[model samples]
Target chain A: MKYNVTITIALKEGMLNPEARAIQHALANLGFPTESLSTARLFKITLDATDAAAARETAGQMCERLLANPVIHNYTIEVE
Target chain B: MKYNVTITIALKEGMLNPEARAIQHALANLGFPTESLSTARLFKITLDATDAAAARETAGQMCERLLANPVIHNYTIEVE
Candidate 1:
């Protein structure tokens, strides 16, 4: 089954500034660098996953790993 | 100015079941009725608002007036 997953990740209040810096560091470590991106709190992602369960699992993983900081960030995932 | 506004309203926990009924009632009151819809906690909305501020304000109004329960439901609005 194909599952459409929409994951929204946002920096918690007072975290956008630092989170953008961290995101930049992470990207540069991965050999890509960019500048002048919005330090907005919200990011929206749309993707197709293998199945509903897997999609949820993967979305959770993505948020924990890269999209959110367990300390100051939270996320919500919707699978349809 | 043209603003793209996306408003998402979902039933909060323990509210979806009743909210759908309320939504149906509201719709019927507005001269439309339907059945066989999902009482899911997540909704996705896309529209164009007048501007960033207006988009945010309208999104909040839609949620408070129709999309969410002030008691049980909470929402986040993102304007891009």
Candidate 2:
């Protein structure tokens, strides 16, 4: 079977998001009132697996091994 | 009122995602069988907006003006 998996990787709390800061500054300058902004990386993977459970496990492994930096990031996996 | 808004920016179809390609290569090298891989940027914004509709509008504007490059990227907005 084939499953479509989505892994959303986000920075752990308290980690500085310089890109978000830059974007906030730009948005403020553009007259958009933004209180705070944070950013993350989302990965969509389509792979063949035995089942949804297998796909989720593989996706999680992928996140830990390559998709996300465990020290500074956390990830969530969704299978469809 | 304070609203939490998320803006997901992704490369439009036909655009090359070198980063995804690199990740895919690394995954394959690691023995993970991946059919296809894609990546996107996800922005989480907390801001003051009159309503959900207003927040969505502001988030969309942010995507258009800065968060995404219209020529090569597309974005989706969610407000909570």
Candidate 3:
């Protein structure tokens, strides 16, 4: 099935550089722009996985590993 | 421009009857199921308005008039 995974994350309030902050911070510290930066929650990411479980797992991994901070960022996933 | 107004509202965390609660309440009290309802935030409401200003205005009215409760439900409008 074609699973639609939409991830929405708001910049932690009071954090400067929502659009470029993360990228620039990474660049300044690590000397490179992290590839996972996104504009806002208005993102639509599509994945064709075998089933809902697999899709959810993939999304969860992405969120935990790269996309969001488990401490401050919370996410809701819908598998359709 | 073809304006795309997507409204997403979550059931208040403590409120019961998310899917049928609002409808049932309206039905029990007002004697009919209210027409305005939705399943989570997976809503895509499309409108072809004349301009961005008009589209924003229309969306604002809809939020204030029906779709969301200003106190709890917040909305983001995108025009494309």
Candidate 4:
């Protein structure tokens, strides 16, 4: 089966995100009042796998091995 | 009301994403064979809004004004 998987990699809570902070400040300047902001990287991958579970597993492995930094990043996987 | 809004900004189809290409090659090296990979930036924002619609509208403005490049990127907003 062909699977399309989406993975979102986010910084762990309490980790400093300079980019997100900058965005919030910029938004405030633009008249959008934001209390806070955080950011993540979303990856959409297509591959052939046996099933949805297989695809999810493969995406997790991808996250751990290459896509995300384990120490500070948390990843979520969705397979379709 | 306090709202949590997420905006996902992705490159439009046919636009080249070099980071995604690099990730695909790196994933290949790590033994996870992916047919293709694409990437996006996700922003999670917390703010005070009248309701979900207001929050969603504000997020759309943020995308248009700062978060996304309208010429090459498409953005989606989800408010909770």
- Write one digit per residue (lDDT tens) for candidate 1, span A17-70: 654466446544553333322232332334345577876886677557554677
Model 4 spans > 4 angstroms off: none
Candidates ranked by TM-score: 2, 4, 3, 1
lDDT of 4 by residue, A1-80 (tens): 99999999999999999988888888999999899899999999999999999999999888888889999999999998
| lDDT per residue as tens, model 2, A1-80 | 98999999998999998988898999999989788888889999999999999999999889888888999998899999
Q: Clashing residue pairs, candidate 3?
A: A17-A21
Task: Output the worst ten-in-a-row residue range by lDDT, candidate 3 chain A.
Answer: A31-40
Q: Give the alpha carbon lDDT tens digit for every residue of B25-45 in model 1.
A: 654455333332223333233
In the range B1-80, model 3's lDDT, one tens digit per residue, is 56665555555545553544543354335332222323344234455567878877766665565556777665666555
Which candidate, 2 or 3, has the higher DockQ? 2
Error of 1 at A65 (Å): 1.0
* TM-score of model number 1, chain B: 0.49
Q: What is the DockQ score of candidate 3, to 2 decimals?
A: 0.02
lDDT of 4 by residue, B21-79 (tens): 99899988888888999999999899999989988888998899999999999999988
State which candidate, 1 or 2, has the greater TM-score.
2
Model 1 bad stretches (over 4 Å): A13-50, B1-80
In order, what lDDT does every prediction score?
A: 0.52, 0.90, 0.53, 0.92
Kindly report which residue pairs in candidate 4 clash with one another.
Answer: none
TM-score of every candidate: 0.33, 0.95, 0.35, 0.95
Q: Is candidate 1 or candidate 4 better by lDDT?
A: 4
